[model samples]
Target: MPSFTRRSLVALLAAGSLGLAACSGTPSATPATPAATASDGALKVGIAQIVNHPSLNDLRDGFKEGMAAAGYVEGSDVVYEERNAAGDQTTLTAIASSYATKDLVVAIATPTAQAMIQALPDTPIFFAGVTDPVGAQLVLSLEDPGGNVTGTSDFPPVADQLALIKEILPEAKTIGLLYSSAETNSHIHADLVKEAAPALGLSVQEATVSNSSEVAQAAESLADVDAFFIGTDNTFVSAIESVVQVAEARQIPLVVSDPDSVARGALAAYAVDYRAQGVQTGTMAAAMLTSGGKAGDIPVERAKDLELSVNPGAAQRMGVTLPQAVLDRAEHTIG
Candidate 1:
């Protein structure tokens, strides 16, 4: 498949620190250690993504924005070669191998990061949107990367998101979970749902798939459940329309982990902003490259701002009625 890309002409870094608010997800990071290196030439940056889902796309675009803010002028101070694996493991591996000679590489999600680390063990690599870097073994620890890899993690507050499901469907007893079996990110969220569901008096019914082609059937298999919950699984999010179709047909209220999918027809979401995460990761990348720092020198950060987004029209389509309280509490509401 052809590579997915955009001309990333992001801005210079803002003058002040972009602080993350205290939250209970991944721990906030300590600032990257800096050591300046004098250079007048542009840096080459390679971005690798597992697929072209909007969340990952947002992360990519945001990374460029962060880099731009860091004072790297696109095509002048910096140049980018972005590649998307289109959900193929072989293509992802090939794409990772191709970035061996670039100044640095940004892997957009867990799978892409894993592939890149495997392909270029000695290269500077930063990952964005990875949910559990520790679980994936991408880093020895978030505070101390201990290797040539470090970046941002997008571990949404799954327990809080599960609570939102119960808030919307007070009498609902079971929520169906659809995710990819191969993704560590998906597994982490699935475990979270299982861990949190009982607290909300809800049981989880899960449907797993290995690829996008199996998505619709997987959604169909969970029709018996009262509601649907989606995570940041790249495969499922890439084929989100199938999940939406099934959810609407069955009139199952759906809650998700990010705003983009809410626009795609899921009823609501509570998630860390993808673009913000990109900027966070981008700044780290800039710090590492400009300061002659290794990836391990920077602390891995999680999203600071978590947004509650709701779409009443989507709720109606999925046969859900949102309480006015939920709508009023939303930071963003999709029409």
Candidate 2:
């Protein structure tokens, strides 16, 4: 396993930023009030995101859009404050604590949600990007959170993802999983993949990393495996290109759980649309704000829109061929 140098990572990020800029468009915004106090009859909302990545960034943008669609326009109906922890636990704790004064707080990832749950035990908390709220212990149950928490879950259809992998590489017998051990969502997805892969005649091999800096090394450790399966792990997704560099070199097909990752060079993905998850979360939060209901009153929702994405060039680089049926079913395909 080769370790990535700081200079190499910087170059990779620079290239990624350029690619993102080329494809990025202005996000839609609505009129919302500046930050205000609850005493003024205005709604105060705080959003704490664990880190800045393409998928999480999209989730954040979609959240604001969803809020606007729900009639809570920013700069008019609601006072919104957004913060990012940059994947630091201490920063997340500070950000969570700062939201204590807010009327409602929306946490974007598992870690941030956990921080909010700890810092604002009684405050209304809406969460997104969480794969398993119950497993993370953020809520008692998905149906009735029974606490100051309820939101959308980004739980990927693990079986569908694995089936896609098998469909692309029917001769594959071992599937490699690259994920972050620190993320509860990663563990949940990894467990599901492990359980589901066996039925597809695939054995699971895992390589865990604690942060983006370790992703290259972890991915390299799994070089001998037949294919790589990346779940919706924030750490891995944040540094996907590094994994792509190795996968392309080794000709290992990379299948991810987020469609956004496919555009980043992964071979394919069959999973939820994270931005839609944010919209669902925001809609639930809007209902609470409108009815003045408690957070616990809303049931935790799952992302309803699932789509398949394939990258033909990526598949070719990884030495895998996508069948016509799979291509026909894909909502999006990148050449």
Candidate 3:
């Protein structure tokens, strides 16, 4: 098998110019084609994603990189038919059903995974960016999936995230939870925050949005809270700038579960590296394809590394101060 490094993948993404398109379920005109082909036969892989956010885009790139590392050359030995749902549930189901006959289908988020599970019961499915597989009922267990589905889970580092919030805002009493109620992962994170906050001497306030348009209003509704916590909820993350605007206007410190969001203006985050999660899922999918293994035989994987990201300028704008110790511990500190 060949080895593809992160540097190589970054170069590939840069050269490809992958950007978010208008909300649509159609495949991009420029699908990621592998430069090399396998000597034996090409493998057809279907990648269905929930939306075109940066984190999901990075996950898609990482999946391709992992396939390359496994000696599955795109265009040559492998071909990827990529589809994005653009945050539309109808599109998600349609995309999943379309990939029902693929050699292997990889779903990037929880909704896509659920759609694939329903649409392709016999087909192998690899899911990434899912927070709670069991809770979503996509699998029976993490250790033993017991079905034709397995992949990586982007379970937020809820405890760590709350700890970071406490470190930065010691006087914080009530932490507001901002997320979409329709997302199972959002519910999981909300429950986690509610369960974890009390021990940290903080209370939890809830604000839910059914869609992205309501995100700002929802955040504003929780103005009584001392701080805001945004989970890896796709709906909320896709419209994070709205939440950021609300946070800045209200001077409420915003903490997120995705490191990429920190770069977008959230104060800080101790979250999973989504690209790494994609690589892990893609590698597993490659192994299954190469060996003709069943998804049921493989156990679901969880993110092993968490990155700490802090933005001091965002902190100052939100009326929070990041102590020197917290700044020193951060793996990424944005300006």
Candidate 4:
């Protein structure tokens, strides 16, 4: 149920859906003014995301949990209008446009955040999944956003992840950097790896993809690389299974920036808990809306609950055996 995407998620499994679930709210089309609520005075919260994937799905769930923790229980004081663009740019714009009139919008990814900001300059937006928010220009600054946008940042701990890759694949030299070129955060992650790799005695070979369809080809192109490291690019993570298939077929060690990919069949990750990130974003959003704090006035948060996760089975499938020390270091492990 959590794996399905978008409007389909609602029709088929809204009762048990994950990312974009149960969106039922009514608000005036007057766009972004405060005090906007549903017909019954419930907060009209819009849940928008670019696509449906494990981490993003957890993000959506975590947001609701966070909001509840902040005393805005769903179906009680707050109501929602959830929308997933399903990776379609046109649909993303439509979702953002619709969210413009809501009291608040929680954008689950960078692309969705960008669309929401563009469509409703005055709307309150709390985002999760953006690695480089400042570079994406969703906010003026993390400390002082200077506008109607502020939320949590899921910047990958690239250096740590790279070091983990090196530890897991000691003889590895050139590492493949696979990501969606369209994601600015992916670029930022790649650059971070390139910048930090040499110090750890590793080189990078990049394979930039424009969309999910290109993932397999991009990965196959980097077949000669000793190992592959993919970051938090929504497009790339959304299509992680393709990369996993290629890795197992070629026996190339695969490391990813997303911890959830471990369950989907990646070796390991040093990642900020994305669900925790959503909680952070939702808490921030609730504070702003409830306490009358301006979006700009709230400081943008950087995710800090980092966890090291590993899949022993994935490593075996990728033709590598993890050392006991590696397993000991992991905060979580999958079969």
Worst 10 residues of 3 by lDDT: 16-25
- Candidate 3 overall lDDT versus native: 0.80
Candidate 3 TM-score, C-alpha based: 0.88
Task: Write down the TM-score of every candidate.
Answer: 0.87, 0.88, 0.88, 0.88
CA RMSD of each candidate after superposition: 11.7, 10.1, 9.4, 10.3
Cα lDDT of model 2 by residue, 286-318, tens digit: 888888889997878888889898999998998
| Poorly placed runs, candidate 2 (over 4 Å) | 1-40
lDDT of each: 0.80, 0.80, 0.80, 0.79
- Candidate 3 residue spans exceeding 4 A from truth: 1-40
lDDT of candidate 1 over 1-335, digit per residue (tens): 11111221011112112111111121222222222343446687888887777888899999999999999878778878877767777677778787888789999988888889989988889999988777666776677776789999888798889888888988999999998877877877787789888988999899988777888899999978999888978878877888899999999887888689988888999998998999998998988878888897787888777999998998989888999899999999897
Q: After superposition, how far is residue 88 of candidate 2 from its true place, in Å?
A: 0.4
